[model samples]
Target: MSIADPAAVREHLLAAAAAGHPLTYSELLGRLGHAFTRPKMRALCVTLAAIDEAAEAAGEPELAVLVVRQSDGLPGQGWWTGSWERHRFTGEWTGPEARRLIERLQGEAYRYWQERRGG
Candidate 1:
């Protein structure tokens, strides 16, 4: 699958979720045969947003939560701010509070996909 294919990306994220691990943005880009570039990262974020919308419609967890920054293991600013309405967070978007929120979301994705796969 290529980076341009949203479906393929979704599947890739689902696999990551099932494995119960989050991936760095650079790691995901590398898996898709691309380097870390701002434009490419923005494009990926677009795809990830679409994936999350579809997943939400299908009653699944947001798969994009599995992709995070290597520094803090939290998603990028776009996710924290843009998707804030969907989440019930009220604290700062850093430190332990933010980490717990991301971890909880990632954990939900992990359990959902893992159980669905009967693994």
Candidate 2:
């Protein structure tokens, strides 16, 4: 799903994915070229969680972790500074961790995001 990219970026993301680590809030501040508000962060989290579900459905356990592609909407950065996500740990996920997404997604807050917007 990723486009052709520099070898360095690819390397960074691969390594980060294996480790499941995200950048801290301090780190994000220095590099943020755009926005990462609370609402935005929450939305992104839901989207990321949805990605895990899709990967599980696809049977590609190895490829289920969206955190591996953790960039500012740009995959492959070796760091998890994607918006407000930097404030927390949503940048990586291992096979076992993928199952947790379902439980989290079903939680009260996320349920609202998954349902119809107006309703």
Candidate 3:
């Protein structure tokens, strides 16, 4: 059973970005009124990917960057494997380097949405 709502999820991510903060996957799941579970998370990832693709097509930053792991405050392996290259990242998707990359992209998303919000 799938419970992913792309528009609602995108709005949640946009709110996170505009607030200049990242949300853990668990948090996002809860916000969507679902409990944390691997299947739900995987489904969310598919929705997130579509959101990112639409954002990219609109020439906007990927909001998926705002959803991260609670342990490391970094996106999960799927993002690293699926998106790292599109951003021209050419290093291990871990450690300080990866953190910096995520931070920068999150900043872009924050700024873009904040500006759109007239903030």
The candidate maximizing lDDT is 3
Query: Better model by lDDT, 2 or 3?
Result: 3
What TM-score, computed on C-alpha atoms, does each candidate reach? 0.94, 0.30, 0.93
How well is each residue in 1-119 modelled by candidate 2, as lDDT tens digits? 11112232223323434444333322232233325454544433444444444544754332213232233322232222332252355635434343364234223222332252322
* TM-score quality measure for candidate 2: 0.30
The positional error of residue 25 in candidate 1, measured at the CA in angstroms, is 0.5
Model 2: worst 10 consecutive residues (lDDT sum)? 1-10
Per-residue lDDT of 1-119 in model 1, one digit per residue for the tens?
46668898887797798788988989999888899998988889999998899889988889888889888889998888777899967788889999988888998998998998754
Error of 3 at 108 (Å): 0.3
Q: Once all C-alphas are superposed, what RMSD does model 3 give against the true structure?
A: 1.7
Residues 7-117 of candidate 3: C-alpha lDDT, one tens digit per residue: 899988888987889999999999988999999999999999999999989999999889999999999988888895698888887799999999999999999999997
What is the C-alpha local distance difference test score of each model?
0.87, 0.34, 0.89
Superposed Cα deviation of residue 24, candidate 3 (Å):
0.4
Pairs that collide in candidate 3 are none
